[model samples]
Structure formats: structure tokens, C-alpha cells
Target: MQAMENGGDLPRRIGVYTVERELGAGGMGTVYLARSRGGRAVAVKVARPELAADPHFRARFRAEVEAARRVGGFHTAPVVDADPDAQAPWLATAYIPGPTLAELIERQGTMNKEQLRSLGAALAEALQAVHACGLVHRDLKPGNIIMADDGPRVLDFGIARAVESTRLTATGAAFGTPGYLAPEQAQGDEVGAAADVFALGAVLVAAAGGSAFGTGTPMGLMYRSVHEPADLSALPGELRSLVASCLSKDPAGRPTPETLLGSLGPDPNPSPDPKTLALATADRPHVAPPVPVEPPADHGRVDEPLRRAPAELSRTPRVMILLIAAAAVASALVGGFLALTRHGDDNKGGGPSVTASDSRRATSQASTPPSTPASSRVAAAPKDRVTVVVTAKSGRSWISAKDHNGQILFDGVLDNGETKNFTDKSQITLVLGDASLLQLVVNGKEVPNDFQPGQVERLTYDRSGEMY
Candidate 1:
């Protein structure tokens, strides 16, 4: 989970809830932090335009919404409300405030054996409820698991089913994150409850600081998941066998969620007090924000070879070979954006491609300065004003900027080579979906940042032109 930021085009109200601010955006649609009429906080997910436009998708969404609402368990965030028949389909869930498992691992390193067991048990229990409700959490990566005070909470259950058989998947593009995908999913085969177990195993491997299969290109990862073995060397010895079974290539061989819960034993650490959880959250420094990225529309074209796989394997099936070829092509076409999207960053709509001409124009503009000097430009502006110029230097990025009063100034995807400017009297809050994809000039000078690729960032700049 990332810090919420203001978006200019945010709806004032969705159904009975008043939208407060944008929590995040992803392939499915933008998610907002809103409050019910009674002042209860909830997270509302609005479907993307393309998706909502499809009648078939909407039917699936409606059914999935009903199924998701039936899912009940302490480990899952319950769905609060939904209106699939609305102009744009939307679903609301009880808001759980906490950092995601991905953020935790990135900040605090790998969890110990005790922590691993607790997380695994909790998630397995959550899956039980989902499966019992006749649904599967097709996508169960680290980003979808929130570490709340009480325990881990699973999110977006049954939602991925709404995306299945849609135009995107019809073209052979597999949904879900590549690294955590099961072999059945990678091959476009029927996915069942066992697929979630496979993903659970992969997520556990990731939490242990080990890539189940060594990472490379998305296609490479999928190929490996299908044909190779997971590297469990970094996993704790006690739990390696359990995790290994979950990552089994054959779904029938994978353990059920019930089996997983029983095998994980008892939770070693009980949930902490609410006060302790609040204090811990307050003590952490503000870091990069995370927005969800939906699966790319053009993701499964086959063009690139599996760089890490053998050139020719006798055991490779013909159907899988064809699927790999298609995936390679799609990956080659949109690898840069899909790479981040696949990892759960905010690139909903997959964004527009940056052409060669756009790159050349951007390079020319960057290399050439304006006629006015930086000092002169700063001097010319009002004393109590701040100006920010954001340019999509390398690729497209979702950007949201707001004024001190929380008025949104700009909100949308900034395509490569495109630029947007905003001025605020006292302060300007900016949220970049992928900080490394853009260049920022505040006041008259270029703002420097060390943000990594696909890293979402939230920054505030005052009249002094200093970022806080």
C-alpha cells in the first residue's frame, strides 16, 4: 500500500461514499480512499473504461462481485458494497491500513522462520474462505497481501476472474504477475484453486528473499516456471519442502490450503495491540508509494526468444512452444511498461507507447535550455509561488498533482515526451507512478531524485522550491 494522493479528475462521490482522495491506480481501474455517509473508511475500486465498456466483462464482474462478497474470513478484507450496473462498475471494501508484504520485505529484509510460518498460515486460511466461496484469487503476489496489526489481509480475491476471457486474455496474454504465476497459468491452461497455492508458494519464496525461479524477462520467468525448478536455497530448511510442494508444476500435486494451514503449525507471535501498530506506522519514514498496475493489453505477443531457456528441449511440448513464442513477441513489444505493470505499479491502461520521434524531441528539449536564465525565471515568479514542470523523459507515467488546499491540478498518464506544468501559491503535492520515467523541474531548476525504476513517489514542494 502507498500514500494516497489527490487526483484532479477524481469523482466527488461514488454510490453512497464520498471520495476523499486517490489511494492508487492499476490495470483494473483507479482505487480511491473514500468515506461512507456514516464516516466509515472504505477503499473503492472503479473499473477502467475499456473494461467497463465490455458487456461480457461486466457480467463476469457482477458475478465475481457477488462471489467476492460471499468470501468471509479474518484474514481477508471484506467487500462492503458494489454497483456493477453503474456507468462505471465499482466495488468497495473495508479499508485496512498497512504496508504491503512487498514494501515490508524491501524495507526490512527477509522474514525469519516464525514470521514466514505465521504469514503462510494466515494467507492459507484466507484462501480457504475464497475457495469455499467458489472463487480463486488468480493473482496472489506479495503486493496483494497487507500486513495489518492483527495479521495479513488478502485483497482482490475473485477479481481476476472478471478479467479472464476478456479481449486481453483472449489474445493469449496471461493475467497475473509473471514471477509468481503457476505453470498452468503460464501455459494458458485452466486455473483452479491449486494455482493460488502455487502462487502462495512463490510469494513465500519471495518473502524469504529468493526468486522461486531466477528473474530475467517476463517471458523468461514464465518459461522457467513451466519447465524449470524453483531455487529454494534461501528458504529456511524447515519450510522448504512445504513451499516446494506448493510450487509443483502439476496442480494435483500441490497441497490444498487446508493442508498448508495444518502443516504451518501454530502462530508463534500473536497480533500486537492497536497502539503498537499505530506507533510503528508513525515511526517509519515516508518512502515510495505503490499504485497497482493492470496487466498490459498488448502483453502476449511472441517475438523474443527465452534468453535463459535452452535453445531446444526434447521435453518441451508443441503447444507450450507456441505459447512461449507468442509471449516473447508481446513482451518484446511492451516489455518496459509491462515489466513494471507485472510487478504491481501504476500503469493502468498500459499507457501509450513513446515513439522514436518523441524520444528525439525530448532529448532535444532536455539538451536545450530556455532563453530565460534560471535565476531570472525564479526572480520573475511571485515570491510566495511554486512552479513545477514534469516531463515524461523515458516513458509514460501516471501523475497526480494537487495544491495546498487539496485541489487537484493535474491527474492522468503523461506520455513520453509530453510535459505538464502546475503552479501553487504555497505548496504543491505531486505523486508520480514511476518516478524514474519522468524529469522534474521545480521553480527554475531541475529537481534531483534517486528514485529507482518503477518506484512510485509522493513529494511536496513549498514556495521555497524545496521538496519535503
Candidate 2:
């Protein structure tokens, strides 16, 4: 049997579902891995008690499940059963196990033309199914998709609408992840299938591979999502035009799902491959990594302002910084279920599995053809150590890593960006904010007076997010 993806902390079962683990958690509820009587493991999402008392909330949740079911396509996670009437209603779907497209990019990164074509085609076909069902998946971020062995599996449908549902909107809330949210949704206008398309555009660019626009910080990404130019700068070649259309400010002008779907089909790998990361210095073995929980701290802690202090890039040790980052990148490659599983085999421990948004990403080359089989799967690979990567494109940017001994381990320049793995040490070299330049600071102190650009240095860190 394939080892669990993100659902490691859940009980053995819940309700009639044999709960295997926690798949992921969201603002409204926690998703668990459970099995049906026929022995199929399912992704079951149960609403939180906070929102369960509201009738409209339950209605919308039910609606999302129904809407997901109506969308007759294999690109989506197949809904097997649901009970919106329960005090805390829940929906269960056949589990498709795999990392998310986001996780895939972090691991494999920026697919070549063939992979892009396949991903675009499969997702477009999925969107066509969604639109045909008279519903819209207001949220279509990379985290919502699994690049399954079968194909791209779209999950978390009804909840977005359920989120937008009037009964649940007593306080006037938003329906989607900020960066991918459409202008209309940002403006609180009536949304339709176009919103999903716009989101799909963002998903495609992200899948094709690019640094996050808003740095995964709430206000900045949301602002950029709404006011910024459709930044497809990271996208290469022919894709830029199509992605731009999906990210267009005007919803009416967006391409129809059918039109987009018609343009996709599998293709062979293309020339000038996207890019390949270096394995590691010949002396060392590739370190396994832990899962990354994208630290969804809140809208307040969004890293935008923190991004403004760009000069700090040179303030810390490159070696320590890179080691920490390598750890994170490695973690992100796991499907987003690591932390929920970390909370460990408990039922009531469901009090909000906290983590950041870019939890996992999955990318794929093949899968089912929009129908037939259901359920997602993953490999039982050994855990990897998340590491720092300094890319070749990172001009003027350098890297530094230091082991717990305060000795510099690895230091170098990332033309764009390069990567390596490290452990959970109190100090580390890291790339700060979203830039390529790395710094060496520990517990908010600069590493050393001699540490300079074009040189390796030592640094430290105590907490996961800061230098020790």
C-alpha cells in the first residue's frame, strides 16, 4: 500500500469511514483519510463546529458537494458520499493520492513544454466539466489540485461556494485564496465560471513554475492579484499569452472553458528543457526532507512589508540560510498532509491543523481520461531534509550554510537559484524574503564582520522562521 500523503495524524476511522489520517485542514474544517465499506480510502472533509450551527453554512456545504458531483469529469476528485445534515456536516470523495502541482514544482520544478501542455490540457478539460455543470470553483489554487498518476484531480469544490454561500457570509467574507482570486471576486461582484478560469490561469503559471507573486503574504498577494499586472514574467514562451488571458482584469473577456479545453492534448517533451537542479556536491548523499506547512500565520503576518527590506539579503550567513531553505523546499515536495499527520492519531485533536498555504504541490504527466476510476495515491518514499537552493538566475545573490558547530558548510552564489538540504539547527544560512541574495543572521544578529558578498559565512537560528 502507498504510504499516506498528508493525513498522518488522523484516527483509524471516523463515522462509517475508516479514518486513516488527516489529509489537510482549512478555515472551515479538517479533511481526513477514511475508507468506505468496499475498502476504498476516501478524502473526507468535516465542517468545524464554529460554522456548523448556521443552516446556510450546512446548505452551502451540501451544495458544494452536489455541485462537485454534478461536474461529470475525471479531472476532479470523485465525491462518493456526504452528510450535510449532520451537526458538523462532512463530504467524502474517493482519495487520489499524490503531491499537489505546487509540491511537484518545488520538487521537480518548471516542467518543459510537453509537461506544461499535458497539465494545461488536463486542467482545461477539468474546467470545461466544471463550467458545464453550472457552477464555479471560486478557488483554484495549486493547493487545490493534485497532479495524480491518473491526471490532475480537482478537490475542494463545494466549499468555495459554500464559503461564498450567504448563510455563511454573515460577516461579509471572501471566497478564494487571495493570489489566484479574480478581480470580480476581489470586488465582491457576482462571480461565474470565468472566475474559475482566471484562477486556472494562475494555477497554470504556478504549475509551469514561478516564484509566488505576493510572496505568499496575504495583503500583498491579494493586492497584486487584484491590482498588479497579470505577472506571468516567470512563464516561458507561448504560455505567457494564454496565461495572461486567464488572468485578465475583465471577467467577460476571459476565454470559455470549452475553448481552452479544445486547445489541450498530450505532447512530447520540448527543446530547451525548463531547467534541472544540481544533485549535490559529489561528496554528499541527497538528504531526505520533512513536509513543509506553508505557515498560514494570518493576513497580518503576510511577508510584503518584510519584503521591502531587501537590503537585508546580505546581512546573514549564506551557508546557514541555504541549509534552512533547502529544508523547506524539500518539505514542500511532500503532499500537504504532513503536519495534520504530525499532530498524530487523535480524533479531537482536530482543532485547526495550522500551516502555511503553499503546503504541497503535485505535477503529473499521465492519469485517467476524465472518467472511470477514482481515488488519489502517493509513494511511500523516505522523508527528505528540506534545503536551500540558490538559482543561477539569482544575480548578485550569494548563499551560506553553517552546521550546529558554527562552521560554514556550503556557500556560493545562485546565478538564479540553487538548492541543498540541512537539518533543524538553531542557526542556518537562508535566502530572506523572496530574493536570490542570501544573508547570515542568527537571533536577529548579523553573522560576522568579515562575512561579505562573494564569500561563505556561518550563521544560526532557533525558531523555524527566524535566525537563531
Identify the candidate with maximal lDDT. Answer: 1
Number of colliding residue pairs in each model: 10, 85
lDDT, candidate 1, at 240 = 81
List the candidate 1 regions with Cα displacement exceeding 4 Å. Answer: 1-7, 169-174, 267-305, 308-468
Candidate 2 lDDT over 1-468, as tens digits, reads: 222355654455555887767778765578888888888889888876756777777777777777778767879887788888876688888889899887888898688656777787788888777778777878788888898998888887647777654322211233467677774564344577778888888887677655335464333454345434555655665566677777765665578777776655543333422232224333444643333333221122223422443333223211111121122455333111100011101112121221321132111112112222111111111223212222232333333344444333433233222333333334344322123144232222333323222221122344443432
Computed on alpha carbons, the lDDT of every model, listed in order, comes to: 0.69, 0.53
RMSD each, Å: 20.2, 23.2
Q: What lDDT would candidate 1 get against the real structure?
A: 0.69
Each candidate's TM vs. the true structure?
0.58, 0.55
In candidate 1, how many clashes are counted?
Answer: 10
